[model samples]
Target: MRAILFVLLLLPALCFGQAAKQKDNPITIGTKQTFHSAILKENRTLWVYVPKSFTAGSKLRYPVMYLLDGEAFFTSMVGTVDYLSALGKMPEMIIVGIESTDRVRDLTPTHSPFWASGEPANDLKTSGGGPNFMAFLEKEVMPYIETRYQTETYRMLVGHSLGGLTALHALVNQPALFTSYVAIDPSVWWDNQLILKQAQKALPQKGSAGKSLFFATANTMNKGMDTVRVVQDNTQGNHNVRNSLLFRETLRKSKNLAWAWKFYPEDNHGSVPFPAQYDALRYFFNKYALDKDLNDSTITVDYIKNHYRAVSAMLQYPVLPAQGTVNSLGYISLGKKQYAKAYQFFKMNLENYPTVGNLHDSMGDYYVKIGDKKKAMEAFRKALSLEEVAETRKKLKELEAGR
Candidate 1:
C-alpha cells in the first residue's frame, strides 16, 4: 500500500517532466539549408526564414542572426524575426540556426568534467570543443552564407545556456568575431564559472565604440526547492549586470566606447531568451543603422533636411529627434558650418528639451543674427521662464532691450 501511494504521490512530477521535455511544436519557415564547415570540418545545417513579402522585389541583403540549438529554437526565432520585422520594431534579417549534431563536443571551451562535485564518468567524455566551433562559424559557415545569400556586413550571434556560454567565450576571446552578441541565461556556473573569470579579464576597459553584447539569465529550480534565490544570485550573483555596469561606467569616465547591459529578473533558465533576443536585436540595429547612401559628398545638408521632412510626412506628425541624438547632430551641424541645418536641429532640440535654458539661450543668439526679432523674443522668453541665474537674467535683460 505504501509503495502504491509513493507512486501516486510522484505522479505529478513525472507528468510535468515528460511535458517539459516533449519536442516543441515543429515551426515551419520560408527557407532552410544544410552544408559542411570547411573551417571546423563538420557537417552543419542552417535554417533560413524570409518573410512572405521578401521575395516580391529588390535584391535586399539583410543582417544575419546566427542562433545556437537549431533544432529546438529555429522555428520560434523565425517567428520572432517575422513578427518583429513586420511591426518595424526590428530590422529584417536572415535567420541562421546552426544545428549542432554533436553539442557536447562543440560547445565547451575546455575538456572538463560536467559537475563541480568531481564525479567520475566516461559517459560524458565527448566534451569541450568551443574554439573549433567558433572557427567553423567564422571561416566556413559565414563565408558560405555570405556568398550564397543577400547579406550585409552587420552580423549578430545568439545562444542560450551552454550555447550562451559559448557565445560569451567567442566574444571575449575573439573580440572581432561578430559585431553584436546576445547570450541568454548563459551557464555562468559552468566549469566553475571559468568563462566568467575570463570575461572579467578580457572585457576591454575602454573603446567599445563598435562592439555590443547583451547577456541575460533565468531562474532554475534547485533540488525541487524554488531556485529563485540561486538564480537571483546568478543574475546578481557574479555581478554580471553590475560588472557590465561598471565597465560602462568606467568607459564613460574614460570616454572609451558605447555599450549597453541589462537584467531580466522574470525569466528562469528556459524562459528568458524570448525577451532578451528581441531587445538585443533592436539594440544592435539601432546602434548600427547602415547608411544606404554611401557617397560622402552626396550626404549634404539638403539630404538631411529631405530625410527629416520625409520622416515627418511618413509619420504624419512632427518627428522630433530624441534629445541625445539631436544634441549630437546639432553640434555636428554647427561644426560643419551648415547654419540652416544646425538651426533645424537646434529648433528640434528646443522642442524636445524646452526646459533646457542653454538651448533656448543659444537659439536666441542665432535668431538675433538672422534678424528675426519675433523669434528671438520667443526664445528669450522661454529661457527666462526657467530658473534664471544672474548670468542668464542678464542675457534676458539684454535681449529684452532689443540689443
Candidate 2:
C-alpha cells in the first residue's frame, strides 16, 4: 500500500514536468540549409531567416534579401529587418545569407596580381571567380529557394567589403537578377578600380530605369585627408574612397537608375556595415508608408486600396493589406454606424479572400446590420460550408427557423 501511494504521487509530478517542458520550449530564430552546388562544385550552406508572420500553410509570399557573408551578418540582419518591419518602416522579408567558402576567389570580378593597395598581391591568384559565384546563385541557389520557399518577385542583394564588390558586379553584369542592390563600402579599388571603370561603361549601356541601388562609403581616408584631399592625393590608402566616389559620380550621371549614396565620416570600414544596412533598407522602402488614422471618418476602403496599389507598383508585386486589418476596419466602421463604409470594407475582404471563413462570417454580420435577412442567410451558409464552426451553424439554424 505504501509503495503504491508513493508511485501514484510521483506520476502526477512527472506528467506536470513533461507538460511544463513542452510549454517552455525555446523558439528558434532560423534554420540552416545546405545543398551541393554544381557551379562551385562544393556544398554550400545557407542561413534562412523567415519572418514572424511566416507560416508553412499560408499562401502569403515574401520578398527575399540575399546577404553576402552569411556567417558574419545573418543574425544582425535578421534582427535589423525584423525590428524595422515591426515599426512599419518596411515590409517583412525573408533573408537568405550565403556563406562564403573563399572570400577572395568568389568575390573578385577580375584576376589580377594587384590588390586594393595598388601593389602586387599573390593572394589574388585564386580570384576572379565572381562570375562563377553569380552563376551558382542564378542557376542553383535561386532556383532552389524559389521552388522550396514562398517567395515574391521582388529580390534584393546586400554585401560588404569584398562581398560588396560582388554585389556591384552582379548589379552591373546581371542586372535582371535582383530588383535592388545594397553595397556597403564595396572594395571598388579591387584590381586598381576595375569595377569603377566597368560601371561607367556598363550602367548606361544596360539602362537601369526600374532598378534601385544604395551604396555607402566609410571614412577610409588617411588621418589628415578629407574628401577633396583624398581625391587629389590619389594615394594607395585613399584608393578605396576615390574609387567609390568615381563610381557614385558615374551612377549619378545615369538618368535611368534610381540610386542613393552616403558617406559616413564617423564610421570606419568595420563599423559602417551595420548603419549602412539600416539606411539602405530605409532608402529602398521609402515609399512603403501608410500614415492614416483608422478611427477617422475620412478613412475609406478606397484609401487603403490606393495606398497598397502604389506599393504594389513600386515593388512590382501584388501587395495587399492584411486580412485582419480589413476586418478590423470593417468592425470599426460598423461600430460607428457607417453602414456603407462597413459594407465596402467587408465586400473588399470577400473579393480579396473569398475562401476565408471569418471574412464571410463578418460579411454575414454586416448583412444582418443592414436588415438584409436573405443575404445574411446566404453569407452565414457560405461561412458554415467553408468551416463547420458551432457558432456559424447555430446562426444558420436560427435564420432557417425564422424562414
TM-score of each: 0.57, 0.85
Clashing pairs in 2: none
* Model 1: per-residue Cα lDDT over 262-329, one tens digit each: 55656666778888777776675452332433233344444555655654443233443334445556
Ten contiguous residues with the weakest lDDT in model 1: 287-296
Flag regions of model 1 displaced more than 4 Å.
1-28, 38-41, 51-53, 117-123, 221-260, 285-403
Off by over 4 Å in 2: 1-24, 364-403
- Steric clash pairs (candidate 1): 207-256, 218-268, 219-268, 233-237
Q: Model 2 clash tally? A: 0
Cα lDDT for residue 218, candidate 1: 55
Q: How close to the true structure is residue 131 of candidate 2, measured as C-alpha lDDT?
A: 87
